[model samples]
Target: MADDGLITIGALARACGLTASALRFYDDCGLLVPVRVDGATGYRYYSEAQVDRGVMIRRLRGIGVPLEAVAEIVDGDGARAERLLDAHVAELAERARAAAVVTRMIKEEIRAGAVLSAAALAAAIEQVRSAAALDREMPILAGVLVESSADSVTVTATDRYRLSTRAMVPVRPSGAAWSVVVDAGELGGIGSWLRGLDEVSVWSADDALILAGGGTERRCGVIDEAYPDYRAMLAGLAPVRTRVVVARDALLAALEDRGAAPIVFLADESGLLLSRDGSACIAATITGPRTELAFSPTTLRPALVSAIGPEIMLDIASADAPVVVRSATDGDLTTLVMPTAIMNSKENDA
Candidate 1:
């Protein structure tokens, strides 16, 4: 008997290239449920739409993925699915390393570079690389400055208006310090691939920056230009006269759909008010005196999105000074977003 447009379990198994028994097991586990069931005979029927999901489950299980992990990958969000696959791949690599494979020993070459967690490197790159300038005249500003020292690895990028810097402790730091400016677009494009590996080694070779991990290496040409003295700029920041702590997501959402217009932020004892003609009040913990600061919503929103935690702290020296945005809990990433003029005080920076 035809079960409307639904296919029987045997047909679904055949369509998805899985055995009927395996489909029954997945059905019993609730990972893949049939669209309809004939209660009289207890026969299950699945829609054609479920064929793709069935094939995905079969493929994932064929690679030795556990039933529970496979279920998550099949049912979870894209990020969760990717993370599960990455963890499984890492586990397989560990198994290969543990295997007693016979091999001849060769002299190992000690490459001058820092070894760090691939996911950490990817996150740091995401946090800072957005600040790189896309100007054609200054090609050097189009790349991110990556520096490795005896203790830590740091990535910094700036577009003259805003600057973002993040530092992380390397798993194995090089004995000597090295620096290279790698193209931001190229580095950012491989962030997903990098996150799949356990560890990555980064070093400069001649005119290119080499990132090697998991038996794979990606080489990107280095810009032969002197980067701005960002460290000195950091050291010369003015004393903070006002500090405000606010919910990161709420503030980010407020900036959405506001267009490219500049938004005014008024911080006082009451709380914080965001206004760009239309006003919205957000509860925030305010420190210091009442202050009004205006900033381009496009420029300021990215800094908030790149912030780590739920709460973010803003330290402002004055109305026209750069505002430092840092996570309330994590201090590894710091972003300085320059403020624009409010109204008739100075020229609009928006």
Candidate 2:
């Protein structure tokens, strides 16, 4: 008995620094099973060799590995098990990086003694409302574009391939007019704090957009430059003959899980082709009569995903022209993306 390789469930649990119930729970979850069971007494016993495996299972589970995956690794080859752990490690690293960025931003805000203003809060909410599909890396350029009689505050951002545009209600301030740009991240952070407010006030001074209301004042820098003429870019496209209504969430889920690009919109009779350097040809379905234009996946997908409505309305010009995607409910926010081309011939010229 002293030399036996087996240990009682209680003893094993103590060795693993876990309770007996936890060990049983792990067995119930298929992560670990006792090596032998007493036929009549229904006693459970685990081999001493299983202690290390049990500890590892507990550690992996604590870190959020699914029970099924943990079982696969516990029973599979060492290399495959290591590969699984490595993938989890990489994911954790990404989460850590994102957390660090947020932590730093919070510390900065606290150090500056900044508070949110009514106008700034409203502008921030409007920014999210207008372009919810804008990429995080894309610069969120928001500011008041003031002219002689009217003042228009606009929020714009582009992932270089696709662009989004949103504008706030025009307000005529009784003073000289000028434009100021603000950082989108800072706006988003302050906006998060000032949720539930109906109106927010903002002022521009010392190259910063200041939000002052609710006894808190926060200052964020404004973006520089006149936002690109997105409106002009979207004008004069040929009418779209073919229109499709698709569920926004379904399409977005498919794209995120499978890396499937957005649906291609083509117009007129021109053929729109898709190909990668080492990938097979991608053919787009023809939903309506032929026309002359096409739109890029980069621009179309983000716009579609950002839409808050249940469905999206896709409209395209000819195969070579810009394609427009609009939220079924809000036509004011439109995304126009140019078509991409494939170069078939290989040539060398000095």
Candidate 3:
């Protein structure tokens, strides 16, 4: 120590296991002030008492604490500093989750085969998992139809009332086209298996369908029976003349509150009217001539739940055809609903 009872910046830095430049920068930033400065030599010095402060500063920075935050702690408000640290910890945790998901998104090309997005596979599984059979009439409807082509793997499912389809891209197509229907009931807990993976490969054997991703493999029984021509149904959809757009959440809220009667959509000059029985329950704007179509909200809510975006557009195809619901922001997700025999408010009273 100098005769003035002050230690030179060099000595202080050595004692604190830090560099003199770091101390100088900290001093300039007002985080740690020097005890003394030589006017002619322009050298900085610290008192022996500042050893603890210097050690704290070095250790805090070593742990990734920002300088501004260190200054707050040095100024005598440790509680506020703790709060800031807690916030940082929370941010790191969220990033970890997102990173895990992204890491699983990397497509690992199949050996002598193509690559597929495992995350997208997981999403497709989720969309169609609930489309299994309601009764025992058609056992084939209880499975999910998955087909892979040159660039995509498409998953489709339907329970007669609604059909859900999702396409995953980056799939290396096979020279020979192949399709299979896997029991969707086996899809339970599949999402958990793909939480941290980036890519997956799919294959099939005599009676089983397999999905391998994130170092995990899952297999389920396949339905040998021919799946209904879902593609034909979608392709043959009738043209539409009226379209009503409503935000998904808003439409869901109105439909969910439909007392006891089936949900009805009445579209005229006064806008679209959503009703439970004969009376109007929720009012929304419609973009075409007078048209009212009724169907069970209980039956229709599932499609709305599956639809994406700030608003869902309802495409009315004549009076007897199915209505298509799609995301307004992006047309990626679509839900098709078959209209009920009941299409007017006057039929409810009788």
User: Which candidate tops lDDT?
Assistant: 1
List candidate 1 segments past 4 Å from native: 1-110, 276-278, 344-350
lDDT per residue, candidate 1, 1-350, as tens digits?
A: 25488889999988999998988888899989998888999898998999999999989988889999998888889999999999999999888766624221111123468889999999999999999997757888898999988899999999988899999999988667889998888886889989889999887777888898999989988888999999998889999999999999988887785678788888987788886333688899999988899999878988998999999999999998889999999999999999998874343334
When summed lDDT is taken over every stretch of 10 residues in candidate 2, the lowest stretch is 273-282
> For residues 1-350, could you state the per-residue lDDT of candidate 2 as single tens digits?
11367899998888787889989898787677898878998878898888898888878888988787798788999999999889988998999999999996775443332223345435434533333334444343333222211344444554445555654443323133344555555555564556655444444565776655566667877656665565566566687766555567655554443243333322222322222221222223345775433334545555676654676666765556555666777664556556655222341010
Best by TM-score: 1
lDDT by residue (1-350, candidate 3, tens digit) is: 77888999989999999899998898889988997899999999898888899898887788677788778776767788788778767877888899877775533232223356767677767766665566657889888887767666678888888887876665655434457898877776777776567877776656876777666777888989999898788889987778887778877777666665766677766666764333544455577667767777656877888776678888887767888878777676667788777645476654
Give each model a TM-score. Answer: 0.67, 0.45, 0.62
TM-score of 1: 0.67
Q: lDDT (0-100) at residue 108 of candidate 2?
A: 46
Model 2 CA deviation exceeding 4 Å by range:
1-152, 170-178, 236-241, 260-288, 291-299, 342-350
- What is the TM-score of candidate 3? 0.62
- Residue pairs in candidate 3 whose N, alpha carbon or C atoms collide under 3 angstroms: 104-197, 104-198, 105-198, 149-173, 150-173, 272-284
Q: Which stretches of candidate 3 lie over 4 Å from their true place?
A: 1-114, 171-176, 276-285, 343-350
Q: In candidate 3, residue 228 scores what lDDT?
A: 86
For all candidates in order, the CA lDDT equals 0.87, 0.57, 0.75
Q: Which pairs, if any, clash in model 1?
A: none
Error of 3 at 124 (Å): 2.1
